[model samples]
Target chain A: MQKMMQQVVCTVDVVLLTLQDSALKVALLKRGRAPFKDVQALPGGYIHPDTDADTRDAALRMLAQKTAIQPPYLEQLATFSGPARDPRGWSISVVYYALVPFDVIGQAGQADVTLASVDKLPRLSFDHRAIVNTAVQRLRGKSQYSSLPCYLAGEAFTLPQLQRIYEALMGEALNKVSFRRKMVEMDMLEAIAGEFSAAGAHRPAQLYRLKPELRDQLTLIARGL
Target chain B: MQKMMQQVVCTVDVVLLTLQDSALKVALLKRGRAPFKDVQALPGGYIHPDTDADTRDAALRMLAQKTAIQPPYLEQLATFSGPARDPRGWSISVVYYALVPFDVIGQAGQADVTLASVDKLPRLSFDHRAIVNTAVQRLRGKSQYSSLPCYLAGEAFTLPQLQRIYEALMGEALNKVSFRRKMVEMDMLEAIAGEFSAAGAHRPAQLYRLKPELRDQLTLIARGL
Candidate 1:
């Protein structure tokens, strides 16, 4: 029975996301060859059986090859599979979403990489549109009560900067006092003592970074704002 | 080049969970054949390419055939893969977890089924122990803010009965007043008017059921208690 069955194609797709121009953007790569020749698609590749040990590793490999960046936060989004999902054969794709810092995007992400705002996404190849949508919901839903947004703010960030990033992702203005209270309640950030920068105001704002314990992982808040 | 690659084995495993004797339990079936022959394993089987159109279908088929019960709540848990995960080459198993009511367990589940307490689980076959652990964490984590617990409470239940189920899974004594407050906040259940029953107390306990809109599906609570 094993020898007679058709092999199911396994692949990994990354919904690489970052904040660009104060908007949440997902990186898309141009296909090198057909079936979707020249079409922009999510960064993806076949999992190399010889080289990759796990699906997560395969996702990392694809991201590294395409973007040359090891994102600070990555999580398996979902597995999308069906006979009709692919043109060649029945295939399964374990989709992952990675958060990249905005400043790092210009220095890396090789040619053919294009960051498209999730709100106004171009028609993506394969079942990628559905995949991207699912990843967005996960990000937004988890962001309400998790230390996930920090991945977009980079290593050193101020409370105001962090609050801005959250606002951009959720597309809403938040009350400054209440937001600060929530950050305190989450206990996910630690103030970087003697580290302050005056961006526009005369008085400098205190810089803070994610606590080591919560870094690169999700820590659920007690409740949503 | 594609033909030269090794074929990945695809299978689906179901962590059919139920509440038994006021404790959480998961269904484990004895494997009849090798490589981990006769070992207690989650109900699983190879995904039939011809008959199964999708991974979820394969999971449901495997569960129904083995358990003789069409589970009320089913969700794709995660996809586990690797070379060493199975003795038979490279394989990927799309794991799904199902919730069944306690009363329905005796009517179905057939022979060869062993309901093991999730807290006091025995050593399972293959990478099953890890799979079970991930599933339990998901169930417990999601339980805090979702209507997921209703799947174990049967079709119609009292608020007190529902609170007891939540308390059992959470391993804590919940304050009745606060629990009712949280239940109202969730908006997933509706009181069944004129359907009060005297189970033990002389005062009748009002019957409540999952709102028609939320039956057999997880409804996210506004906040976790």
Candidate 2:
């Protein structure tokens, strides 16, 4: 019965992603406790079953306590579990990934949290490397036909600016006319009143922001950009 | 310390979906033990940390033991957890959704299992009703731009047969020319040697099967059907 009753360790981890200098980056912090202590890893903590309402809440709490950043968009990524994953015992981690603008992460000024280029990440704690990969894959895959890249482009941006962000995530240049057409199909953006990008002396492109209702959700298009 | 040491109940549930009579259906079983004994619910069981290699293994085990059906395509849907979801205590159920041909499920011949149309499901135990909705939504959403619906069409089928399966999941009629174009873009199917669907008066349609490598993974198209 003791073996049958053996408890599985439950925790929540966050893969906070941002776009910086045209490259995708993930937030990492030095583990303050044993079991990979002092090693850089995704922000994580044990789930407080008594106090936490759910895993999402636990994930938000861990982010606030560890990095002092509350992302505007957060979604559950996937759960990673196994007997050999953790040194302590059988364990499970309900992972969530958050998207934030580059400036927002910089504004948070998390001294302990460092941003690492996803393309050149160092050795991460536990299975965090794989977790980060999964999150990045999800972001890129969804970027094909959804407004997911908008979160990385900040609250307001010009069409050209948004296309650059999409190109960065998708790793390819998209046809401009078709890209705009797909954006129209998505219908998740609106012109920011009286706002335009200062594009030298030629033309000032109108700035746009995600519709209020779509800020927390993705607007998907049928044909990808 | 004891309160902090409290164990969260870990379980795995599967949402097995198939198409029966042109309607999307889900598999369910009657619970054999308390707390909700005799209740019809998604097949689920506790995680055997000592034996199961991972949560996916646990999910597969539950499906095999309860329904006697092994699916050709099974993917982790998401993890559902909270204190109130289960009366036992704080619990985590890693949910997986499987897609199989209707006849495969029928051939299993499990006496205790039953199929219910997704659109008209009866009251399910726990948060199962919500879980069912999520699975159905996932199926419908992916059906627009993926080979996911092919799993419900069986190993070998004609283009017309596949299109009908896609229509059933998508809940809309697709233009034939565009649908075939999208299929060509997906590039996950191949003509089966010397196989064709019989037609009473016209030419037989060539039978196709998913490419060997694409069977276990989804083939996603940029533009949807």
Candidate 3:
């Protein structure tokens, strides 16, 4: 007698996010087949067996294949599963959220890289809308108490640039003085030894990079802080 | 010409959690049949076709069926998908983290309510261990800035009881004064205007319940606080 085994299908989805024109934008791909054909959706694909380290790596591979973009920062977002989420059957998707510097993704300039405002994105396919909504909420929430927003900013950035990313993500303005104080108190930022070079801005403000040691500490602090 | 329809199989797993004797315990059920027969695992099953709300609803349904307990609070933890996560074929599990009052679970007292501590849990079957680990990390992370630990407390609880739950989940000790101050600042707790009748070694402390409005606020805060 042979024993029957239960089979399940898994997939990974990527929500590639970038800051463009002071607005947060997400990378979306147009589905090409039935099930939510021709609808705008996040870049995703099946969980390949040999090419990736984990679900996150699978998401990166899918993103690279579909959009020719390799996001610099990726984090696991919540997963979505519903009996009817897929018209097909019981499929579960592990969603990963990625933050790419505007210049990096903007450099790709693929037609699929739509720059819709985070607040006013098009109707996404499947439960993609809910997945994106939760990712945005997590991004905003972590930004309040961690150095995560720094990943969304360029390698080196002015305090205001960092603040703007927070504002864009949170959909609200923050007091510069208070925000700076909070950052300093967290001790996650390091002054880059001098002021910014005279560029296209008001007065050249000081530049800073996130302290490396602080990421793990922030990970722990962000857990319950 | 034939149009192709893509179908995927999905499942829901619940990592039901409660505080027992000042330690974090996860609810696991014994697998009765193959894949991993008779092995301990998180209580879960396939999403029923009829009357299932979503993956989350399906997880709740499974929990109810297995443990005869209904979690008042359930949140999507993450989706687990790997080509080989299941022995049969490609499978994905939509995992959910549930917080139920210890007293409520104790009241149910179902014969199968196997409460295993995070530190010394039995060898869990499948990727259920990984799923539970992920949920535990997420729970500790959320407990820091959210009022999540309060949910583990019974109807009425003392500050010390609440503090102990936080300590157990985070695996760290906190100063009582600072913890109280932080909780008060959040404005999510309302004092019950009385003291605990069952006194322990320490002085009988004041009791508090979560404010109703705070539930909505907590959902927001738990995302990243």
What digit string (tens of lDDT, one per residue) describes model 2 on residues B64-172?
Answer: 9988888899999999988999998888889999998999988899988899999999878889999999999988998888889999989899998999999889888
Q: Is the docking of candidate 2 incorrect, acceptable, medium or high quality?
A: medium
- Winner on lDDT between 1 and 3 is 1
lDDT of 2 by residue, A29-86 (tens): 9988889998899999888888888899999999999888888899999999998888
C-alpha DockQ of every model? 0.53, 0.60, 0.33
Query: In terms of lDDT, which candidate is strongest?
Result: 2
For every model shown, what is its TM-score relative to the native structure?
0.96, 0.96, 0.82
DockQ of candidate 1, scored on C-alphas against the true complex (2 decimals)? 0.53
- The CAPRI quality class of candidate 3 comes to acceptable
Off by over 4 Å in 3: A1-11, A33-38, A45-54, A83-91, A171-196, A200-225, B1-9, B172-178, B190-207, B212-225
| Candidate 1: docking tier | medium
Ranking by lDDT, best first? 2, 1, 3
Output the better candidate (2/3) by lDDT. 2
Off by over 4 Å in 1: A3-5, B1-5
lDDT of 3 by residue, A169-191 (tens): 76788898878777776777888
